[model samples]
Every structure is written in C-alpha cells, then in structure tokens.
Target: MEIVMSGIAKAFGTNQVLRDVSITLKEGEVHALMGENGAGKSTLMNILTGIHKADAGTITIDGVERTFPNPREAELNGVAFIHQELNIWPNLTLLENLYLMRPKRNKFGMLDKKAMLAEAENTCRELGIELPLTTEAGLCSVGHQQMTEILRILMLDAKVVIMDEPTAALTERETATLFKMMRKMKARGVAIVYISHRMEEVFSECDKITVMRDGHTIITKPTSEISVDEVVRHMVGRSIDEFYPARTTTPGEVVMSVDNLKPEGFDNDISFSLRKGEILGVAGLMGAGRTEIMRAIFGVDKHNGGTVTVNGSVLNCKKPEDAIKAGIAFITENRKSEGLILDFSIGSNITLPNLDDICPSHVLDSGKLNSFADELSKKLGVKTQSIHEPASSLSGGNQQKVVIAKWVGKKPSIIIMDEPTRGIDIGAKRDIYDLMNELTNDGVSIIMVSSELPEVLGMSDRVMVIHEGRVAGILDRSDATPESIMTLATGGQ
Candidate 1:
C-alpha cells in the first residue's frame, strides 16, 4: 500500500499552520515526520486522520483520491493513529481494553470472549510482547500498555500506523522492545509514521526523514544520507553553537537537603542536596524514582519517613501549601494536566500559584492580577495576544514559559523542575535554558530531573544518579561523564 498527501494547507483564524506540505509513505518502510513544535506537523496529521478538514489538499491512496471526514472513515480505509497518550482503561484487562470499541461477535450475536482472548494472545506472541493478556491494563507498565495499543491497531489490519512520540516515556529496555516490534511490523509491509523529538530514535529506527519548518516541507532524505547537525539545522533554520548555556556562577551555601527521605512505594533510601546558585541535575532511567524524589520534597507525594531542611530550617511539608509557603516551587512534568489548567486564561494560570500575593487583605485585585500576569508573560517572552487568552491557545514552548513564570512570580528560593523540556520545540528549549541560567545566576537554586543525558550533563553543576529510589552517586560537573552516569544509574558504586 502507498499513501500520498499533496499540497496540504490548513489555517486557523488567520494563522496559517500548514502550507504546501507534501509527504509520501510506502509499504515496508518507516517515515519520520521531523519538526519543531508548532511547525504544523500535528495539523498535517490531523488533516490526514480526518480529525480536521484541510483548507486545500489531496490525499491519494494507491492512486485513488480519498478523503477521511472522520476518524472512523480513516480507520475503515486502513489508517490508524496511536497517540502519545495511550487511551486505555486501567481497570479493564488488556484483552478487554483492546477490544473495547470493536468487539468480535459470535454467530449468536453475543460477544466472542474466547476468540478475542485467543487473538490477543496470538498477536502478543507474534509481536514479541511479553505482557500477559489477563493482567489489568492499568497494572502493566507504560511499554506494555503501548504494545497492547499496537496490537489493537494490527488487529484492524491497518496498512498505515501513525505513532506519536511512541518511546518518549519508555525506558531504554522498553524502547528496544518497541523498536523490535516496529521492525517486525515493517517486515510485514506496514507503513509506520513515527513522530518523535528524540534525534537518536529517528536515526536509529526510521528509513526516510521528512523535515518541516514553519508549515513547509524542508526536505526529505534517507537517514543514512543526513547527519544530526544537518537535520537540526533544517528544523531550526540555523545552527546552534551551544545546546546548553554555560554556567556563570559557582555554588554557594546549601539551600535544601533531603536526608534519607523515604517515599511510599519504594524501599530504598533517597538523599540529595541543592546549593544556592546551583543547577543540581538528577539523572536516572524511567522508574528509577527520580520524579518520586522531587514529588516527596515538593509535598506532591507524601514521604513515609525523613525530614526536609530548607535554608537552615527543618519544616515538615505535609501538603503542597506548606511547601509553597516555605518558598519552594515545583514545575511538574505533565504540564498540560498539572502545571497549567488548559481551559484557564494565560493570566489565570500564571497567577494561579501566586494568588495569595495578588489577593492579600482578604480582597481580590483584578487590576493587580492582570498587571502581574502581563509582567511575567513579557519577562518570559511568552507569545500571546492577550493575558486573558486561554493557555491552551499558546504553543508548547510558550506554555512551558508560563509554567516557569508562575513559579518565578512566587519568589521561591529553590525550584524543582521535572522533565523541563519534554514535548517542546528546540527553540523553546533554548529559551528555557537561558531562563534557567538567569534564575541560577540570581541565587535561585534549581533541582532538575531529566531523562535526557545530554541535557543533564550540559546544564548541571553537579549530577545525581538515582537507582531504584536510592542515591547511586553524585558527581561534580568535571567528574560526570555519560559512562559514569549510566554506570551509577544501573546501580554501579
């Protein structure tokens, strides 16, 4: 099967998202759609998947012009989209979740439970998915849940499968398993549309690369013919001298300390410290309890045992309010859900955390709220028409800036950022790094938990490796290396 999209154009309220975009996918190949955030990649995919109508475009499958008015129509035409966020119910069994919408009916018109289970198990066996079918979908790891989604897509006999950030949250081992599955699908003549921000995955897994910049197709080339630098240049329209900004200050006195902190659901001890004017990076594999440690400190997750000391005072942070009152800010990993309320206005979300400051003396100040939000938005370079505009209206990078601005407004001495740059564009990432540098230079200590090794290494003054909820090791900037960090992450002493 072959699919071609030509002259795709889409616009939203005078904002042209896609212009003259074209792409082709062939059987037995993986095509990577590479672009920075807000580059119209999602818009193009939405048009192709029938989620949105294109202003002008032609979609031809096997030489026949086609249009998918709805997702079901696209599915009926042998196209399936596996979004980054898995849409599976945890309470149901894997088999149950897979066949939730499309259930096999026996001749008697009853649900075919036995056949469904058999097919699910056989599919798993064929795809090399080790997850069991009887287990609850929620109980399985993220990788297993993703595998189940893929299995469902295969059951539909989809000719084309679109995977968005498929391995973003997967561990190294899980990613390997996903790659193995992708290869099998490719061998079976399944055209895979793999969308990811990780450059390594594109080079390692994809066959052809399609670069899009500012709603236009930049170039399409074989992965073997392109270098990472070349791809990045095409995506950003320029070369980046430094992906991470250089540190300008030395660490001062310790600002925060976690001594033998023990959070729920883990047996190991956790300990770390952050100094004023320091960017202390926490590196670990997925499920290594890196986020868990931050949650414990920020009071998002209750710690079973241990004490938290902040700026020479020991305070028990039983709730987030306590942590906030104690001058600590936590920028959560899942920004859309936790960091900002999508339906809320930019000004509302920015001022949400610091409401107490703007609303003192038991009175609400509308003027103060808008002015404060406007100040923060401008300071963080948030691209928005009005502070009253919804946060969901902004691009990924700008929303992240809003998250940081919200915390900065509180005047916290220490900031905790989890997966700070996940799901954002390269340009936005550079802006965030610059902001971090500025914040650290102002004596605001930062504890950043990240899965990207380069980011941790480049931005950190000291790197702390977490292994299964325990502090594997902490190394000074000069002493930390990829090998050393990985060794510690894998439980090496």
Candidate 2:
C-alpha cells in the first residue's frame, strides 16, 4: 500500500498543532517519524486514522482520495494502529483478546471457537510466535502482550500499520523479537509508520526517516542519508553541545542510608546510601526489583525488615507522609497516574503537595498559592498559558516538568526520580538533566532510577546495579561502562 498526506493543518482553539505537514509512505517499507513532544507527530497520525478531522489537508491511499470516518473504518479498509500502551483485556485469555473485536459466529448463532483457534494457530505458526493462548493476558509478559496486538493487526490483513513507540517498555530480547516481526511484515508488502525517539532502533530497523519540528515537516530522507546529529538538530532547531551536563561538585557526608531492606516479595535484601550533592543511579533489567526497593524506601510499599536513616534519624516507614515530612520526595515511574491529577490545574497540583507552605497559620492564601505556582512554573520552564490551565492540557514533556516542579516547591533535601526521562522528547530530557545538575549543585541529593543505560551512565556519580532482588554491585562514575553495568545486571561477577 502507498499512502500520501499533504498540506495537513489542524488547530485546537488558538493552538495550531500541525502546519502544512506532508509525508509519503511507500509499499513494503518501514518509515520512521521522529520529533520532540508537542511536535505534532501524533496529531498527524490521528488525523490520518480519522481520530480527528484535519482543518485543511488531503490523504490518498493508492492514489485514491480517502478520509476514514473512524479508526474502525480505517482498520476495516486495511489500516491498523498499535499504540505504545498495549490495549489488552487482562482478565481475558490471549485468544479472547485477539478475537474480541471480530468474533466469528456459526450457523446456529453461537461463537465459532474452532474457526478462531485454527486461524490464530495458522498465523502464529507462519509468524514463528508461540504462546499459551488459553492463559490470561495479565499473566503473560509485556513482550507477549505486545505480540498479541501485532498479531491482531496482521489478522485484519492490514496493508498499512502505524506503531507509536512500539518498544518503549520492552526488554532487549523483546525488542529484537518486535524488529524481527517488522521484517516479516515488510516482506509481505506491508507499510509501517514507526514513531520512536530511540535513534539507534530507527536507524537499524527503518528504511526511511522523517523529522518534524514545531508542527511542520522538516525533512524526509533515507535512513542512510542522515546522521543522528543532523536528525536531532532538525528536531530541536538548534545544536546541543552537551545533552548531559558534567558533574563537577564533590559529594559531602551521607544524607540517607538503607540497612538490609527486605521489602515483601523480595528474594534478597537491598542496601544503598545517598550523599549530599550526589546522584545515585539505580540500574537493572525489568522485574529486577529496582522499583520495589524505591517504593519500599519511600513508604509506598511494605518492608518486612529494614531501617531507613535520614540525616542520622530513624524514619518510620508506616506511610508516604512520613517520608514527605522528613524532607524526601518521590517521583514515580507512572507519572500520569501517581504524580499528577490530570483534571486539576497546574497550580492546584503544585499546591496539593505543599499545602503547608501555601496555607500557613491554618488559613488558605490564594495570592500566595498563585505566586508559588507562578514561581515554580517559570523556574522549571513549564510551557503553559497560565498555571490555572488544566494539567491535561500540557504535553508529556511539560507535564513531567510540572511533576518535578510540584516536588521542587516543597524544598526537599532528598529526591527520588524513577524513569525521569521516559516518554519525553530529547530536548526536554536535556532540560531535566540540567535541572538535576542544578539541584545536586545546590546540596540536594538525588536517587535516579532509570531503565535507559545511557541515562544512568551519563548522569550518575555512582551506579548501582541490581540482579534479581539483590544488589549486584556499585561502581564509581569512571568505572560504570555499559559492559560492566550489564554484566552486573545479568548476574555476572
């Protein structure tokens, strides 16, 4: 299938999301769409699949004009979209989830289980996919759930498939499997629109690349023609000399220490220490108990045994309030659900955490709240019309900034950031790194838990690798190479 989108323009109130964007997708090719958050890449795709009508544009499939009324219509016409967040019914079996949308019925008007099973088995055999079809979806691994989505698309016989950040949550092995499936689809004359910020994957798996900036298409070229630097420059509209700032300050005395923390469901005890003005990076494979340790330390989860000492004082791990009252803040990995209330205004979200600062003497001060919100928003570079605007209105990168700002307002001495740069654009990542450096420089210690190896290596003063539920090893900044970290993460000595 060949698809062409030209002169696409969309506006939400006064915000012009897409301005004169154009792109072409050829048959049997993998085309990559690269951009920062709020760059209008998702908007363009939404318009193509009929999620939203473009204010002015034209889309043609196989040289014929078309505008699908809805995603279901697009899918019926051989177009499918698999979003980053897999839409799987956890309570149902894998087979049930796959055939839920289009179930076959027999002459008696009952469900045709035999037909569905045979068809699914045939497709799985052809694609080299193996899974327990009768098992519940929630019991399967993330990779399996993702493959189910892809298989569902293939079952539709989709000529064109659009993937948005397909491997964002997959492990290395799972990512390889996903790329292999893409190759199989390409051989069958299917077109793929791949959207991701991971440059390495795009360069390795995609045939063509298109970079978008500020609601406009900057350039579209073969993957071989453009360098990573050029693509980043085009996406950000400037050259970034330093994506991760160098750490210059020396850490002072230890501020927090964990002594043999045995969180529930852990097979081994965990221990770590954070010093003043230092960044302690936690790295591990998925299901390696990296997040479990953080949640237990922050009182979000129960610990069977351990003692947390903050500035030589024992902390009561009874609730999250204890940690917060002791001048510690946690930024969870699932920011949308735990970090911010989407319907609340940015100002209200900020005020939720620091009510004491905003409302002292048992009285609420509206003026003080506004000033506090304004101060943090401007300081953190939150791109919003006003602090009163709903948090849902901001982009992912900006919402992350708001989450950080919400904690920064509390003036905490110790901050724990889990997946700080996940799902954000590169430019915003640079901003967050700079902010972390500034925070550490000002004597605020940081515990950064990240899945991205480059991020942990680039921003850490000390790198701690966890294998299974145990602390594998800790290395100084100079000793934390990719090989060294991965070796420890995989249980190598």
Candidate 3:
C-alpha cells in the first residue's frame, strides 16, 4: 500500500506547528523523517497515526481517501505508531501487554490463555527478542520493553508502521536486532516511516529521506543522492563541521574516585578514577546497570557498599541533596521526569538549584534570576522567545539545555550525564558537545553514560563497557573500537 499525505496544515492557536507538509511512503521501503527538535516531525507523525487530526489535508492510503478520528480507526485500517516513549503497562506481564486488545475467547466465553502465550512467545522468538512471557513489563529492561512494543505492532499486523526514535534507548546489539527486524518488515511489504535524530541511522537504513524544518517540509530525496552533511544542513539551516569539539586542556589530578561500588541489581566491584578535564564514557546494554551506577554515585540511588573520594577527601552522600552540596551534579536520563519542572518557567527551572544565590537574605530576587537564566540560555543557544515562557512550551533540545543550565548554575566540580543527547536534534547535540569541551577545559570532570557507540567513542577519553551488572571491560580511546566494545559488552571476552 502507498501512503500519500498532501497539504497538511495544523496549528495550536497562534503557533503554527505544520504548514503545507507533504510526504509519501511506498510499500516495502523505509522512509526516514529528519528535522530539528521543534520541526514538524512529531506533529506530522501524530496526524498520520490519528493522535492528532490535521486541520487541512488529504490522506490517501492505497489510492483511497480515508479519515481517522482516533488511533483505533487508524489501527483498524492497518496503521500503527510505535511512540518514542513506550506506552506499555508496567504492571502487566509481557504476554498480557502484547495481547491486551486482541484476546482469544474459549467456547465458554472465557479468555484463552494458553493460545495467547504460545502466540506471543512465537512472535518474540521470530523477532529475535528473548523476553520472558511471565515477567512484568516493569521488571524487564528498557531494551526488552522496546522489543515488547515492537512485538505489539507486529501482532496487530500493521501495514504501515511509524517508529518514532526507535533506537533512542537501545544499545549496539539491540540496535542491530532492530535493524534486522526492520529489514524483515520491509521484506514483508510494510511501509515504514522512521523518525530519528541520528543521521548515520537515517542514511544507513532508510531508502528515502524527508527533511522537515520549522513546521514545513523542506525536501524528500532518495537516500543514495544525499549525505549526512546535506541532511543536517537542511534541518538546521547551517553546516556544523565538528560535532564534538576538540579537547582544550589535558587531564590533571584525579578529582573523583570510586572503589568497590556496589548498588542493588549491580554487584560488580566497580573502581574508576575521573581526572579533571576528562570525559569518561560508560557504555552498556539497556539493563547493564550504567544508569544505576551513576545514580548511586550521585546519591540518587543508595549504594550497598562503596567509597567515594573527592579531591582526596572521603565524602558522605546519602541523598541527592548531599551530592549537590558536595559539588556534584547529575543530569538524569529521562529529562522530562527527572530533570525539569515542566510547568515552571525557563528562569524558574534554571534558578531552582541555586535559589539562595539568586535570592539572598530571604528575599526573592527576580532580576538576578532572570539575568542568570538569560546568560545560560544565550550561552547554550537555547531557542526561545522569552525566559518567562513555560519550559514545557520549548522543544526537547531546549528543555535539555534548561536542565544543563540549572545544574551549571551550581558550578559542580564533577558532573554525571546519562543519555544527555537522547532525544535532541543534531544542532543541539553539537551545542552539547561544545559545552562538554568547555566544561572539561575549565577542569570539571564528567562521567557520561550513552548507548550510542559513535558518541561514546567520539566524546570520551576512555570507555568503560558494562554488562549484566558488571564492568565488562575498560578501554582507552585508542582501543575503544566498536568491535572491541561490542565484544566486551556482549560477553564475547
């Protein structure tokens, strides 16, 4: 089936989100939609999946005009959307979540449990996903949860699958598995619309590329005819040569040291030293305890046993506040939930951590707060009309900047970032890389957790691969090849 969208226009009062956007997806081909954070990619996908209705447009599937008032209607018509944020019920078992809508009933009008389990198990195996059927969705790892979502779409027998940031939380091996599944879907004549910020994935996996900019369609070209630079140029209206800035200063004395760190679900005797002016990368599979380790180090999670020494002085950290007061900042992986207070204004969010600095003598100093927010916003190149606007109104990239600014105001000696560049666009990613370089030059030690191999390899002075709650291996920059890291991450050595 061919999916054709023409003259799509949508708006939220005075904010026009999409205008004159057009795209087409042919059966058996993967079409990638690339754009900046505020670009109309998500809006357009929502309109296609019936999450949002287009104010003006014509959607023709298989040469027949159709109307979808809701997602159920679209699903019934063979369209399914795998959102970036998985919508699985955490409390439900994998089989239950997968077969939630479609249930086989016995002759007595009772639910057919055995058949459902068998079908779910078979589907998962065929997709090369090894998820326990009886395990609760919440108990499964992030990678498994993602696989469950993909299985749900497959179970629906959807003809057109729209995947939004499908590989955002996936590790290298899991990403390879997803690519294989995508190829299988294409072989089965399913039209796939892939939305992603990673340019390499777009060029490597997509048959055609559609670039969107500021609520409008820029162009749609065959993948063979375009390069990553060209696509990024169209998305941001500028060319960025060095995504990761060159390191300015060499690493000095060790600033932070962790020895024999042991947290729940991660029992490995982890020992590592972070020196000033160095960025250390933590790479692992989704369940490999990378985030848990960071959380424990930053006192967001309790450590069963460990010793943390900063500047040769042992520090007691039992809570996030303790870590903050001890000159450590943590940027969470899920920025929306853990990092920012979305309802607050940009200034409020940025100044939340350092309220005392902005408001001395128990008096609220709005002027100082605004000045700090403005300075950080300008420094980070956060695109916004006003500092008083709600943080929720900004794009994902800008929201991330607000999180960074909030912590940067504290001027922590050590910073831990988990998936810092997860959902942002290319332009914002470059900005973040530049910021990391600047911070390192200022002698701040950084501990970064990322699932993207290229980013882990490019930004880190040394890479640590974790697997199954253990430090699988540690490699210096010169030895941190993709093959080498994967070998350790997958337990090959």
TM-score leader: 3
User: What lDDT score is found at residue 258 in candidate 1?
Assistant: 87
Model 1 earns a TM-score of 0.92
Model 2 segments more than 4 A misplaced: 85-96, 103-155
Q: Whose lDDT is greatest here?
A: 2
lDDT for each residue of candidate 3 in 1-493, tens digit (9 for 90 to 100): 8999999999988889999999999999999999999898988989987889899989998899886889888898899999887888989998888888888888999989898988887876777778878999888767788888888887888899999898887766678889998998999999999999987888899999999999999989999999888888899998978667776668889989988988866657788889888899999778888988888888878888889998888878888888888899999988886899999999899988898877878688788888998998888888998989999999888999999998998999999999999978888898899899999989888999999888899899989899888888889998999999888888878
Cα lDDT of model 1 by residue, 1-493, tens digit:
8999999999998899999999999999999998888888878888889999999989999999988888888888888898766878989998898899899999999999999988887876776556668899877755578777767777888889898887766667667878987897899999999888888889999999999999999999999999889888999999977788888989999989888889988897787888999999999878788887888888888888888999989968998899999999999877886899999999999998888888877587999999999999999999888999999998878989999999999999999999899767777899999999999999999999887888899999999999987899999999999999999999887
Pick the winner on lDDT between candidates 2 and 3: 2
- What is each predicted model's overall lDDT from 0 to 1? 0.88, 0.90, 0.88
Backbone clashes in model 2, listed as residue pairs: none
Q: Each model's RMSD to truth, in Å?
A: 2.5, 2.7, 1.9
Ranking by lDDT: 2, 3, 1
| C-alpha RMSD (angstroms) for model 1 | 2.5
TM-score of each: 0.92, 0.92, 0.95
Supply the global lDDT for candidate 2: 0.90
Runs of candidate 1 with Cα error greater than 4 angstroms are 90-95, 104-151
